[model samples]
Target chain A: MADFATIGQQFVQFYYNTFDVDRKNLAGLYRDNSMLTFESAAVAGTAGIIEKLVSLPFQKVEHRVDTLDAQPSSEAGGILVLVTGALKVDEEQKPMSYTQVFQLNPDGAGSYYIFNDIFKIIYSAA
Target chain B: MADFATIGQQFVQFYYNTFDVDRKNLAGLYRDNSMLTFESAAVAGTAGIIEKLVSLPFQKVEHRVDTLDAQPSSEAGGILVLVTGALKVDEEQKPMSYTQVFQLNPDGAGSYYIFNDIFKIIYSAA
Candidate 1:
């Protein structure tokens, strides 16, 4: 088996970086069967996921990742990455914290694609 | 239905606060049938979960929450809260960020207990 932890860390960094700059480019990281649960909305397929992202209420956003943890799954070449970070939208006074779980499957050549993603915002401290 | 979003946010805050201070006291937040997935380990029941906590390596800890989001679930009186935060254990220089999913069931009188909990530490930014 390959070093899943190493690969998973790299994938996390790449995914978040791309999401901040060129979200459209992220399309390559997903396949036709990808699934995304944005808060309460469940979006399936790469196209539908992209559509939801483009239609988000926030215009400008910044993601500050605080932690990234990855573990191998029972399935071959499958990895689960749990990300906890803060998202800043526009000029909001406080950034919204979020927890996102990503199930990635190897697509060969040390690359992986997101199979499933679930994201939710955390509670405000105030 | 009641305002799920508001109640969920409040629950998230109270849960984390209690976790940091009196972890032992957290037993009240879980019933005998509660479920927990801590890292790769699956623990069932409040007794098992509390045992896992006492066995952790860290002695002193602090949690810094970044974001919190909650939504109502199909289950009656059930709320799902996703938390993103940084955890500082002992004297570690770098805090580990984590994403936790909590399924809370109202126990009446504005009180709630965890039915299911999933937690994972994120990747180290360095």
Candidate 2:
């Protein structure tokens, strides 16, 4: 399993890679059974998740990890990491900021999937 | 230190009490120096956080915990719990559901401050 810090860094990279449609790297960050719930709608399984990840139209996605907090799960050996940070999207080369939250399980030899992936746009009003 | 499950449950309870302006119970959940970062606005210290919490005019605040994921923090003794859940707020008796994320350190002795508290409102369209 990767350490918390290593896993945390990977998450930020994963966010950018996914948003920018970096299909090769995106495949490594998530598991085959990973799922995503956007707001209230559920998108189950990794394939569905990848479908959504590659669909974002942002020209560039930059993620800054402010903090990566982790704890033990109810299951004896499981882990739950909450990644909180700011994201800047380059839409037509214009920078737009946003807040993102990601929960991941980084244990043993596998990095596994994202338990949660949520973001809200934060940008200066035109 | 409270176990992961116990700490996880308190996280949900903390959300309701804090948002409902239940300042009394709120005192127990967070640390004395707990700070809150709202969207992108910085609200420093527990006092500042309370001011923001009590200022909300929702008729009632109800919070729920769907899944509590925990992992080990960088600190040897510190455990970081990332709580992922759904919340229903009774604003004028109209149910409003939203997604909430709370990162906390529930190790021992005292339940420290929230590492992260961010939520987005979700409602059905007319």
Candidate 3:
């Protein structure tokens, strides 16, 4: 599953890079019907997704991914990726840890776009 | 918040209960378009989902949920729930741990149905 691993790592890297610099560039990663859940709020469409990212309280943010697992789906050309990471926003607030899952649908050869994304800040389960 | 917590707990209990005895009863929880990811396989439609469950090698299975976190979604009637648990298939095989996430969309007043679910076995990150 090198393809899965490579594509997963590449997509994660591209996502965080774009999220840090040109949030707008991330638009192409989603379709009009894509669903993104930030915290608990669900946003739909490319415009809404971009707006949600750009409107984050922190202007400068960085994500450090700890664990990334990708699995090909039974659905034609679909992939499931799970990411666990910590996000540092600006320099003041404490870094927040998160777990995110994404369902990707193939857009083209070796290319996939996010179809469903669920992101949550990890509050201790204990 | 209470509503979310209550519904989350109730659903989890109801799910495991039905999963143990009458697996068919779980059918009402899903729609034709609902997506359930079992390991890396994605199954759609209620019939497909039920088939996947019953086809499991284990006949008598039990699930013990450890963490159940629920958040209300921005969607008018959607709820996002994350579950971490352990499952024992039978007397012979060792227990398997798992993490599952579910997106529930409102079906009727105070009623919801699973729209998307992702389930994975934990093999350890370290």
- What lDDT is reached at residue A105 by model 3? 70
What TM-score number comes out for model 2?
Answer: 0.48
The better-scoring model by TM-score among 1 and 2 is 1
For model 3, what is the alpha-carbon lDDT of residue A12? Answer: 87
Q: DockQ score of candidate 2?
A: 0.08
Give me candidate 1's TM-score against the actual structure. 0.56
Model 2 docking category: incorrect
Q: lDDT tens string, model 1, A1-126?
A: 458668777888898888888677788888877777787587878889898887888777889877666655323566666777788887886777677877677777666888767787765332
User: Per-residue lDDT for A66-123 in model 2, tens only?
Assistant: 5454433323233344444455566544443333455565445654556545444432
Worst 10 residues of 1 chain A by lDDT: A71-80
If the candidates were sorted by their TM-score against the true structure, best first, what order would they fall in?
A: 3, 1, 2
Q: Write the per-residue lDDT of candidate 2 for residues B1-126, one digit (tens) a residue.
A: 566546666666665667566644565555654545443344655667667766665555666554444433333333344334444456444443343455565436565556445444432211
For each of the candidates, the C-alpha root-mean-square deviation to the true structure, in angstroms, is: 8.4, 9.7, 7.5
- Error in Å for residue B62 of model 2: 2.0
Each predicted complex: what DockQ? Answer: 0.10, 0.08, 0.10
lDDT of 1 by residue, B1-126 (tens): 458678877777787788788787789989886777787577878999999876888887788877666654323566656677778888886777677877677777667888767787755322
For model 3, name the residue pairs that clash: none
- In candidate 3, stretches whose alpha carbon ends up further than 4 angstroms from where it belongs are A1-126
Q: Output per-candidate TM-scores for chain A, rounded to 2 decimals.
A: 0.91, 0.63, 0.90
| TM-score for each of the candidates | 0.56, 0.48, 0.57
